[model samples]
Structures are given as structure tokens and as C-alpha cells.
Target: MPPDPHADELRSPPEPFSSRRPTWDDVGRVADLLAAAERTRTGVVATRAEDVRVRWLMLDGLEDVVLVEEPGPEPVLVGVGEYSTELDLLDEATVVHVEGQVHPAATGRGIATHLLDLAETRARSAAAEEGAETAIVRTTVIDGDDRARAWFSTRGFVPVRHLLTMRLSLDEPPRPPTWPEGITTRRFRPGRDEVRAWTAHSAAFADVPTHFPLTLEEWVEDRILRDPAFDPSLTQLACDPDGEVVGLAFCRAGVEGAPEEGWVRDLGVVPAWRGRGLGMALLLDALGTFRTRGLTGAALDVDDVTIGPAVRLYERAGLRIVRRIDVVERLTSTG
Candidate 1:
């Protein structure tokens, strides 16, 4: 047989990368890697180092998180992944959330696959440890990313929910929020209003299918109190005549990628206050607050399946759908 010219090329292996459990010291670089990936994929940078720190704090430890890097004098992070599990006590199911991202330059090099494998392994172990009767693993991808959709589909995940990222520009004057009669608004008081706000949120979202009320401690620890970007002055609470919280607007000064824009982290009205247009008032109040802060825009994400009222209220307040994320899940175990 004649010598083949491409045999050497076929024999050569792909470039090598290293993966290890992430540590607190890696938080900033992980955030940078994630931000870079987001920018390459969506032209937006929303992963701040603080956000990454909060996420790591939520985990039991950093062992479940993996970071992939190109080995060199100054190693570059090319991929990252993590998995966490929550036991749905009411539903008797364990929900595992697997998240991962790879640098655009490293796509198709099997980095994502390796990360996903690690995430799933951690997920399964966590679910088993919780002794859940059923295990479901979930992940999310941008709505229009067909490659990502196909990747999850082949891995047995099916699209289950759609979340809309809505944005309202503050270039023009925003419509002033009109409070319902006898209802007044005030800024959140860090020490005094934390429990009250949590109670209000839990009541407001009680009917939401995907929402499981977090305990006051869990709620406070998640993002509101711990996030360095949380500005109490920017967070508004609508109270009835008796000084009870009826509605709330939780706003963050800025998100990781878009500091010029304010983030409406949460807006909700209790069921008793729902029909009085308090939801719209809270939303507008958030927008107004953002505008007053000199932010160029305001943004928030809503679950389309569960929060129809929120979507309509946001649209009425001039926020348009800027992006969509699809949540996909796989039922890994029936028992």
C-alpha cells in the first residue's frame, strides 16, 4: 500500500486541558470566564464576581464545581460547570440543576461534554443522598441556540419552560407609578423589613407552580441581603394604611455585564392586592427608581408559564422581551 500523507495528522491528539474542583480563589476568574462566554454567546455580560461568590456560598462546598483550564504559565479557564440539588418536599422529587459554560474559542473540543459529565455525576450522587423518590435534572440554554438545544435533547432533556428577559429603556421619562388609594410605598429597611418582605413574597407567589417558598433565612441568604449590589434605597415596598407590606419591588443597582442598567430582581403583590393594579404600580416604581438612579435601562426575567400577569404588567410598563431562555429537564429516575 502507498504511504498515506495524512496518517500523521490523524494520529495527532487534540490539545490538552485540565479540570479540577474550583476554590474560593478561583471565583473571580470563573466569573470572568462565564462573562466572556456569555458575551460571545449573547453579547451580554451578566456574570459578576459577586454573583459567582453568592452562588458558591449557596453550595455545600466547592467540590461539586469544576473548572477546566489550558495548562501554561498563566492557565486560562476554558470551561466551568456545577451542579446542585434541591429536594421538593411537597412533590417528593429531587431537582438537580446543572449549569455549565465553555469559552467560544474552546467549542467542539469536548470541554463542555467533560464538564456535563462531571455535573451529572455530582447530581446523581446528591439525589441519592437525599433519598428522593424521583430525580429530575434541569439545565437552561438561550432560546435561539439550536446547537445547545440539540445537545441537551441528545442527552435526554426536553424543553419544559421558557423564561423571558424583559428590558425597559430609560431614555425617555417613565410613566409615574400611581399607588392605589390608602397604599403608600417606602424603601426596604435592611434589619426591620427582611422578614416582612419574605412573607409578602411567599404569599404573592404561593400560586406559582414553579415557586416553592423559601424560608426566611434561605430567602435572605439567597441574594437580597448578601448581594453587595443590593441597594435598599432602590428596593421599594408598598404598604397598606396599617403599615403592612402588600407589594414589593426588589431592585439591584446593576447586573454583572450591564452596570448602566438596573435589575428588577423581584416584583410582587399579595393575592389580596393583585386586582387593584398594585403589581403595575410596583413595576413602574422599580422602573422609576432605576431611572432616578441614572440607569440607562431596567431588566428582569419572568417565567412565561407561571407568571402571565407579570409578563403583561411588564409589557404595559414599556418593558419589551429582550431575550429568552429555555429550561430543559430530564427525568433521570422514576424511583
Candidate 2:
């Protein structure tokens, strides 16, 4: 099988290494690798697939060694890559980001540690070119993936925020709320314009400390080009009398796994849109959609300390945290 079209195309001058871009042929094998390594503790199927695609970059470069299991009667897990990565500045600041995968079979080896170090050096160099002061590398470990989290902490990252995987059983009818006076909610049918909706989303979320301002092209690419990100019928939007998209709830499903589960990649009712019960209404609508699709449950991840008391709301709705994970940042040399 050929590599996936979405995999990065490597164009470096000839070197001793050989890299093969991961194709669709690699997806099933990669999926097996993830299961065997127990690398991912809990995640939406779509999100996991995205990670698989991102990791293909190291393979295409070939310079990064791959320890994949020999494809035969019984495949085994091996590690991938040793690529050094560095800074990619956003606007004027140097940024540190890492996207790589592990061979589930090779869990105890310090492969991830080595990759992170190489990437950190690249990040520092990238920051230097941009005249930025600091950079931070990031990764996630499932609550069950204790060893991985310890590995990250040993290298300097700390637990900053805890994310909870919450689920709402969709077997029953959702009791949606009635919006407050002058505020109304509706579904965002496919093919309609979402520019203003995006604008509202941007304005409402402008205060989030470290979010990137995505261009319209990027938004389109994210929601449209991404196959698993489709299914607009599952989206609900809240609007005011002036027709502003102040609140939004979007749900997507996993193709590789359970079809009976609808995952909420995001559900936010802008601050201005809050207090009117729009959040609950949007959530109810999403749950209804999931139920309509015959899904047994609806899932979403929320920050334990979000701007609003989201955890409380989920608890009230009969949803409980199924998994817990943390994201930490090492404050750069702040003067």
C-alpha cells in the first residue's frame, strides 16, 4: 500500500538515512502499534488518527531511525525516529511544539526522551533566530501511562492543567433548556456561511492565553478537509437577535472504533452568551444529535479549571470524568 497523501513530503538533499512517508498502508499497522504500546491512554479515534499522520514526518526523512516491527505473521512494536526539531515562531515569538509517535511494543526504551531532547535543541535554535527568550516542549501521558508522565517530568515539564474525559449517556432523551429572553439557539446546517460564526468564536475566545488565531483557510481546512471532522448536522449554534453566533457545540465520531459514541471536540458558549443557559442547551442539542445517530454515549474533554465551572455542569448532567491527564509548561527564563 502507498503512503497517505496527507503525509509530509520530504525534500532534503541525499543523506545516509532513508525515510518512508507513512501511507494508508501504515494506518492499520500504526493503529496496532498504538494498542500494543499502550501509548495513548484515552482519546477520540479521530484525534488518534491525526497523530498517526503527524508522526509520518520523521519516517519520510529517513535520517531518523525507525524501529518498527518486521511486518510478518505477527507484527511487533518498535520505535520510530530521532529527528531534531526546533522553533517555528508564531507572529514574533519562538514556539516549541513536538508531534511524534511511539512503537507501543517498545515502551520501556527511552526513545521518546531522546526525540524530545533533539526537538528542544531545535526549538532553542529557532527561538534564537527570532530573538525570543524561551521555548517549552509539550507531551501528554494518560493517567494510566504513569511511566510516560514520569519521563516528561524527569525532563523538566510539570503538570499545569488537568483534562477530564467526560461522557453523557445518549440512550435517553436530552432535557434541553429554554434560552433566556431575547436569546435563541439553533442548529448550523451544512453549507451555510460560518464567517460571522467564526468571528463570534474568535471574539468570545479572545481572552484564552495561548490560542493561535487561525485564518479562514485554516478553519476550512480543519473542519472540511479533515474527514473525521465533518458531519455538520451534529453542530448547534446559538444566536442573538442581531444574528451573531455567540455559542457553538460541535460533535464528531470515530471511524476506526465505536460508532455508538459521539465526541465533542469542543463546546463553548461565549462569555456574553452565558448565564442564559446556552451552554446546557447546546450540550443538550449535541447529546440529542448523538442519540439520534444511535450512539450510546457522547464524550468531551474539559479543563478542570476552565474559565467557567464546566466540571460542575457536566456532573449535574450525569456525566463523569472517565480519564484524567495533565499539560504542563516550563516557564522560559522569565526575567
Index of the highest-lDDT prediction: 1
The collision pairs in model 2 are 3-23, 4-23, 18-62, 19-62, 37-104, 86-122, 86-123, 87-123
- Write down the lDDT that model 1 would get: 0.79
lDDT of 1 by residue, 82-103 (tens): 7777875655777778788888
Error of 1 at 221 (Å): 6.0
Residue 318 local lDDT, model 2: 75
Worst 10 residues of 2 by lDDT: 9-18
- List all candidate RMSDs to the true structure: 8.4, 6.5
Candidate 1 lDDT at 134 equals 52
TM-score of each: 0.74, 0.68
Model 1: residues >4 Å from true position, as ranges?
1-17, 21-62, 69-78, 85-92, 103-109, 189-199, 214-231, 241-244, 333-335
lDDT of 1 at 44: 78
